[model samples]
Target: MALGLALPAAAQNVDGVVRPAWAPSGLPDRVVLSPGADAARQMAVAWRTDARQADAVAEIVEAIDGPAFESRARTVDGLSTDGVVRGGHGRYHTVRFTDLKPGAGYLYRVKGADGWSEWLSFRTAADEAAPFRILYFGDTQNSILSKGARTIRAGLMRTSPDVVVHAGDLTGRSHDWEWGEWTAAGGYGYAMVPQIPAAGNHEYSDDDDGRRRLGPLWAAQFALPENGAEGVVETSYYTDYQGVRFIVLDGTAGTSLDALDAQTRWLDRTLASSTARWNIVIQHQPIYTCARPNDTEALKAAWEPIYRARNVDMVLQGHDHCYSRITDGDGKASGEARRAQGAAQGPVYVVSVAGPKMYGLNDRALTQPDRVAADTQMYQTIDVEAGRLRYRAYTVSGVLYDAVDVVRAADGTKTLREPVESLPPLRLCDGDVGPDGAPCVGSAK
Candidate 1:
């Protein structure tokens, strides 16, 4: 059976099986950078190679303009974990670089059985409260290399964010071929920009004993901070970058497993102890969903109170393969009306999609969402500063769809104001017709 989709640049289809082009041979592939607990002073990198490279070896140096910086490079040894997957057997290596100068630029490369990878460059976050940018995506779960790659490339070239946040569902069924397509889609962008990802339901599947388990490749592909709620530490963690504290939650586990209470308690404690000027929550399920018939009641009940009381500036989510920016939870009034009525602004809840799969909006889409879209692929760029956070959403082709700024006053109050430029009309299905006048792929829930 031929998979009716475009083959990834490095993949091949043979005998009804999709084979990974990056089946972890010599030469490091799928190189990804992740933020440490302390973004300024620490950084982590993870890569894969075949068993021939039993040891994890890498080299780092303070990068200089001249070509002789390699002379000052220092070798670093890391640990490796062996894993078996559909495509092949390989070892995943992870290394954390510490005791580095804050706000410093550095270069690093990994070793494989055959040779060394090309040097990759990255800069540590500044130690002080400063301005930075974050590029966000939702659910690159389907058609990753063909459709999703364009959005990633567009965001990278247009904004060049210091960090990237993924709101889960990175693959359709967590298959090795899907993961390979994902890594190929991002290419070297994954190697340079640090990623903070939340685990979606697709990342979890039931084991033989009926226990829900995270995907086998998740831990191997991305190195993330371990500071999180006790049981779900791998999926729930926090990383502070610049003036923002990004708290990631495992919504899948919280909703399905017996981890909701623990996560709620941890979220409250973490938020209470936060020292950053702005707080943002990254989770896979949305508090105010746009596609499903009803909201994710389980997670919303468990975590929404903490978000409200703790003053979480934004709640970024995926799972709903549509787009929505909801500021008023009650669905009582428009965001502009509430602002005009002097309403105390709460967290801005946003759900966006970057993949080909899409769902039609539900009944609440009529009035609840300040902005909503269907049958669309979207990406967002957020510029965070001490006084304001500027958010802009764009299409895969780089058309601006939505823009807003959350202005923080001296007394810590926030106001959501739109940019002076007008936005395009909402992208929604016109009865049986899609926004583009094609056969509607966005099916109703």
Candidate 2:
């Protein structure tokens, strides 16, 4: 039988332009927007592209009138390009735009060898103490695309946060595919919101081919504050925004007790000197874990006292793929047990996860934490108002699972409130799997 076969138009091939079949099918990936010192004045951006277009440049413009606010066009400084071999070959670049006015929206584009990327837009943070929102996620290291991506996307859709905080483990490994997954999970939200990432254990590797190092992709991906400790540059640093101060610490450095000692001293000085009303500290390891053993004694012995002495508001951590809100400083339940122990004010330690990896809750988690969750994917949104902070945790499906509000009275006493909100089932597991056939193994001791 004679059949008339029609073939689709052959893919267009242009001379001198290299495009890989499996490269980022869409626009540039891992787009990040960072606020500069002036908020309204300066900002930074980073993104990844396919290897074919290694030397790519970015175009930025200020949006003015309409909802799009199309403004004048200008070119910003481009960063050095590097090769990333993931599922295939890829390239990554970063760019920084300075001298911008505070609290202004800027639209940008990336020009590659093949074509130019779409116009991505971002706004600088207001230079003054204006209300803003931030999204916090933890341990998006494994199952990034399948399970973690949806949670992150949901969080972004639910709350158009001004900035995002990664507690740690942005990728399972420092490989190209993992990085691609990380950026994909974030998607366009990364470009819209500035990212503040902490260094986790997964970000480190041992020396094998003399190429092993700590935080290789981190420095290249984000333009952070450089005012960290003397030797610990990228791993440990602090940034100030509006009325808050965020201090990040690195626990991987083991030069000696001297290293942690130096960090402790720096932390004390930073907290003591900061005039900001809110002081939040971020790190990978939790001082009080709900899934793992109590192994943060070194940090506790060194930094906890400082946090308490300085009235630090909150301490956020991730590494144990679970959720916990430890308040009252007792690290114990808020009943007779705490009264018997006679505890006082201390920093509220919260350990949470946003990815699919699940861990069974520890035995102590049952009564020790004021609120706890196990074997679940979750994210946190924290809203800071004048003398009041509201924190709410949600499941991947946008269900409000847990919530707490801390109101600081004029006398400096913080009060906690649990509003009457219907939450999902507690969903705790005793063994490796829950009734829903999901693995819930607790953290390794």
Best by lDDT: 1
Judge candidate 1 against the unseen true structure and give its global Cα lDDT, from 0 to 1: 0.86
Model 2 misplaced regions, further than 4 Å: 1-27, 37-40, 50-56, 67-71, 84-91, 209-212, 254-258, 334-345, 432-444
Alpha-carbon runs more than 4 Å astray in model 1: 1-20, 85-88, 332-335
Q: Candidate 2 residues 302-329, lDDT tens each?
A: 8888888898888989988888888854
Model 1 per-residue lDDT tens digits across residues 1-445? 1101223465534343535575668888878899899999888999988889999888999989988898899998887888574233578888888877789999999999999989988899999889999999999988788788777777777778899999999987666667788887777788888999899999887889988888888988888998999899889999888888999999988988889989999999999999999999999999999999889999888898888899999999999999999988876376677789887789999999999899989989879988899999999999998899999999888889989899989998899877897888988888888888987798778
- Clashing pairs for predicted structure model 2, backbone only: 40-101, 40-102, 40-103, 41-100, 41-101, 41-102, 63-69, 64-69, 360-441, 360-442
Global fold similarity of model 1 (TM-score): 0.95
Best-performing candidate as measured by TM-score: 1
For residue 362, what is the lDDT in candidate 1?
92
Q: Model 2, residue 229: displacement in angstroms?
A: 2.1
**Backbone clashes under 3 angstroms, per model:** 0, 10
Q: What is the TM-score of each candidate against the true structure?
A: 0.95, 0.85
lDDT of 2 at 127: 66
